[model samples]
Target: MRLSRAFQPTLKEVPSEAQIASHRLMLRAGLIRQTAAGIYAWLPAGLRVLRNIARIVREEQDAIGAQEVLMPTIQSADLWRRSGRYDAYGPEMLRLKDRHERELLYGPTNEEMITDLFGGAVKSYRELPQVLYQIQWKFRDEVRPRFGVMRGREFFMKDAYTFDADYEGAVKSYRRMMLAYLRTFQRLGVRAVPMVADTGPIGGNLSHEFLILAPTGESGVFYDAALEEQDWLSEPVDIDDSASLAAFFDKVTHFYAATDEKHDEAAWAEVPEGRRREGRGIEVGHIFYFGTKYSESMGISVSGPDGAPLYPEMGSYGIGVSRLVGAIIEASHDEAGLIWPDAVAPYKAAILNLKPGDSATDAVCERLYAAGAEIFLYDDRAERAGVKFNDADLMGHPWQMIVGPRGAKDGTVELKRRATGERFELSVEDALAKVLGA
Candidate 1:
C-alpha cells in the first residue's frame, strides 16, 4: 500500500482525551477515529489490524476443532426472558423496540441464543460435544466508555459456546478452550496470564480471565513468574485425550495466580519470594464453565444414553477481538508508537522511499515492493526522510526497508528491525530474503 494513496490520517499532536497509551497512539497513528462516546469507526489501518487479530483468533479456534458460525448482532429479548436474564442484565444491555413493538436488543453475549439454537438441533448424547464460535460486533451501553477501543461501547468480539452432555465433557471443553486461549495470546505477542477471576454475570463457578501485563492496566494481578516463561504451543495437547487435557490444566493451575478478587495471601506466601510477581494487567479474554445455566433456564434438553432427558452442560469462551488491538498496544508499545507483533501487524514491513522520485532510489524501492508486495507497505509519499522515519516508527511495522540515494545507487538498502532498532545494510536480494523469508 502506498502512503500517498492510503487513508491513514495520522495526527502530529496527541489527542487530549486519550488517557491511555493505546488510545493516544491509535489516534496519532491514524488507526481509528471516534464517531461517538465509547464508539469508533475503524479506519482502514485500524480495520486491517483488527482483521489480522481476528484471523489469528479464528485459526486458533479452528485448530481446537471449534466450528465457526455467524450469529446476529440484534437478538430477541424473548431469548433473554426465557433464560431469566431479561430483567437481570441491567442497563448495559442495549434494549430497544422494533416496528412491531417487540422487545429487542443488541446482544452483549450469545449464551442464551446459542443454547437455544443448538438445543433445537441436537437431540441426543451422540451430538453431545460441539463448539461453535463467531467473530462479530457487540454493543454494551457503558455508562462511561473511555480509553478508546479498550473500553468502547461498540466493539468486535470472538465468542464461542460449548455444549456437552455431562459435567465431565464440560470440563474437557473448558480445558480445551483454556489451552486455545493460551496459544492465541502467545501468538498475539503478549504474555497473558490466566488468573482465577470472578464470574461477573457469566455465572460460572469455574472461570479464568486472561490478563496481559501493562503498567496502565486496571486490574491488579498476582502470579508466579514462571507462567510468563511457558511456551504453550510447544506442548502437544490432545483435546481428545481427557487425561492429557487434565494434566495440562493441572500443570498451569498449580501456579499461584489470581486477580485481586481471588487473591489469597496464604497461597501467595507459599510461592518463592523471588518467583512472586505482581503487576497491573488488562483482561483480553475469558473462559467459563457454567453447567446447565442456560440449558436448564431455557428448557433445553436432550436424551441421555439411558433415554432420560438431560440438560447439556455449557461453557462460553470470549476473546476481546477489537479490544485486543488496544490491549496489545498497552502491553507492547514504546514511547515512539506501537511495536506490533509480526503475527498481528497489518503489514509485516514498510518500504521507506527516502527519495521517492530519485531514479535509483525509486528503482530499488519498486523492486523491494514488487518482491514482497503482499507483506509490505510502500511509503512512496513525497514526505521528508525524517517524516517517513517517524511515521514508520509510529505505525510499527516489524521490519522497515530504507531505500536512500546512496544505498540505492550502490544497489543496497538498509533493513531495520522495528522492535530493537537493529539495522543492516545489504543487497536488494538480501534485504528481500530477510523480510520475505527467501
Candidate 2:
C-alpha cells in the first residue's frame, strides 16, 4: 500500500487523553481514532493489523477443529432471560428497546444465544462434541474505558463455544483449547502465561486467563519461570486423544501460575526463589469450562447413549482480537515507536522512498515494491527523509527498506530491522532476499 494513497492520519504529538504507551502510539501512529469515549474507528492501517490478528486466531481455532460461524451483535433479551441472566448481567449488558417496544440488548457475550441455537438443532449423543467460533464485535458499557483498544467498550473478539455430551468430554475439549490458545499466542510472538483465574459471570469452576507481561499492565501476576520454556505446539499431544490432552494439561498446570486475584501464598512459597517471576500482566485471552451452566439453564437436552435426556457440558474460549493490537504494542514497543513482531505486523516490510520523486530513488523503490508488493507498505509520499524514517518506525513494520538517493544510484538499499535497530547496506537483490527471509 502506498502511503500517499493510504488514509493513515498520523499525529506528531501524543494525544493528552492517551494514558498508556499503546494508546499514545496508536494515536500518534495513525492506527486508530476515537469516535466516542471508549470507542474507536479503526483506520486502514489499524484494520490491517486487526485482520492479521484475527486471521491468526481463526487459523488456530480451525486447527483445533472449531467451525467458524457468525453471531449477531444485537441479541434478543429473551435469550438472556431464558438463561436466567437478564437481570443478573447488570448495566454493562447494553439494554435497549426496539421500535416495537420489545426488549433487546447488545450481547456482551454469547453463551445464552449459542446455547439456544444449538439446543434447538442438535439432539442425541451423536452430535455430542462440537466447537463453534466467531470473530465479531462486542460492546460492554465500561464506566471508564481507557488504554485504547486494550479496554475499549467496543472491540473485536474471537469467542468459541464447545459442547460435549459428558463431563469427561468437556474436560477434553477444555484441554485442547488450552493447548490451542498457547500455540496461538506463541505464533503471535508474545509470551502469554496461562494463569488460573476466576470464572466471574461466565460461571465455571475451571478457568484460565492468558496474560501477556508488560510493565504497564493492569494487574500484577505471579508465576514460575518454567512456564515460559514450553513450546506447546511442538508437544506431542493429539487433540483427538483424551488421555494425551489430559497429560498435556497436567504438564502445564504442574507449574505455579496465577494472577494476583487468585495468588496463593502457600503455592508461591513452594516455588524455588530463583524461578519466581512477578510482574504486571495484561489479559489477552480467557477460557472456561462451564459444564452444564448454559445447557441446563436453557433446557438444552440431548439423548445419551442410554437414551436418557442429558445436558451437554459447555465451555467458552475467547481471545481478544482487537485488544491484542494494543497488548502487542504495550509488550513490544520502544522509545522511537511501536516495535511490531514479524508474525503479526500489518506489513512484513516497508519500502521507504527517502526521495519520493527523485528518479534514482523512485526507480529503486519501485523495483523493491514490485518484488514484494503484496506484503510491502511502500512509502511513496513526498516527505522528507526524516519524516519517512520516523513514520516507518512509528508504524513498526518488521523491516524497513530504506531507498536513499546514494543507495538508489548504486542499485542498493539499506535494510533496517525494527526490533533491534540494526541496519545493513546491501545490493537490491540481497535486500530482497533478506526481507523475504530467503
Candidate 3:
C-alpha cells in the first residue's frame, strides 16, 4: 500500500465540530468522514481498522461456542410489539411503514426477533442451551449524535443472544460471556473493567458494563488495582464445568468495582487505600442476564423433560464494534496521533522512503517493501522527511522503517517504535527480521 496511491485523505486542520480526541484524530488520520448528522462513511483506513477489530471479536465469540449468524437490519415492528416494547421504545427507534403499509423498524436490538426465530426452530429441552450472535449495523436515533463514531446514530455492533431452559443454565451462559468479554478486550490491547450497571431500556436486573479507562471519559470509575493485572487468557476455566465457571466468576467479582452511580462508600472503605484506583472510563461492552424477558414476552417456549411447555431463560451481550474504534483511540492515543495496538493496526509498519528518487534509498525501501509487502505501507510519495515522519507518527503504525540516503549507503536503516519513540539502526536484513519478525 503506497501512500501516493492510497485513498487516505488526511486533513491538515482538525474539524471544528470534532469535540473529542478520537474524533479529531480520526478525521486527521483519514479514517472516517461524516455523511449525515450521525452517520459516517468509513474510509479505507477506517474500514481496515474496523475489520481488524471485528475479526478479533468474531474469533473470541467463536471460542466461547457462540455460533455466528446474520440478522437483517430492518425488523418487523410487530416483533417489538409482541415483546411489549414497540410503543415504549421511544423516538430512538426508527419506525416506518413499508410499501404494503406494513409497520417495520430499523432494529435497535434483536431480542424479540431472535426469540421468535429460536422458538420457531427449537421445540424441546434438548436444544435448551444455545448461543447465537451477529455482527451487524444498528441504529439508535440519538437526539444529539456527536463525538464521531462514539455517539453515532448508525454503528456496527456484535449482539449475542442466549437461551437456556432454566435459571441456573442462564447464569452459566452469562458468566461464559463475561469471561469471553474479558479475554476479548485483553487481546485487543485495552484494559476494560466490568462494573455493575443499570439495565436501562434493555430491562435486566443483572447487568455489567465493561468500561475502558481514559482521561477524557464520560464515567468516573473506582476499582481495585488487582482487576487490571489479570491474565485472563491463561485462566483455565472449563465452560462446561459449573463449579469451575462459578469459581472464575467469584474471582472476577471479588474485587470491588463500580461506576459513580453504583459506588458505595462502605465497600470503598474495605478496599486497601493504596490498592484503590480512580479514573474516568468509556463504556465499550455490556452483558445482561434477563431471564425469560424476551422469551416470555414473545411467547417463545419449548417442551420440558416432563412434557410441559417452558419459556427459555435468556440473556443479551453486546459490544459496540464501531464505537470501540473511537473508544480505543480515547484510551490509547498520544498527542501525536492514534497509537494503534499491533493487533488492530491497519498496517504493522510504514516504510518511510526519506529520499524516494535517490537510487540508493529507493533500492533499500523497495527491497524492504518487497520482503513484507502485505504488512507494510510504503510511503513512496516524494514528500519531505519531516512530512513522512509526521504522517507515519499520525498513522501510528507499530514500527516505522526509515530509509535515508546515508543509511542506504551504509546498508542500514533506522527502525522507530511508535509507542516508545525508540529508534534502532540495523542492517537491512536485521531490520526486516526485527519488524517482520524472525
Best by TM-score: 1
The lDDT per prediction is 0.91, 0.90, 0.91
TM-score of each: 0.97, 0.97, 0.96
Give one digit per residue, the lDDT tens place, for model 2 in 195-265. 99977765655899999888888878999999888765665778799889988888888899998878999
**Model 3: worst 10 consecutive residues (lDDT sum):** 197-206
Least accurate 10 contiguous residues by lDDT in model 2: 197-206
**CA lDDT, candidate 1, residue 406:** 97
Give the clash count for each candidate.
0, 0, 0
State the displacement of the C-alpha of residue 371, model 1, in Å, after optimal TM-score superposition: 1.5
For model 1, give the RMSD to the true fold. 1.4
Residue 341 displacement in candidate 3 (angstroms): 0.4
**Which of candidates 2 and 3 reaches a greater lDDT?**
3
| Model 2, global lDDT | 0.90
Residue 271 lDDT in model 3? 97
Clash pairs detected, candidate 3: none
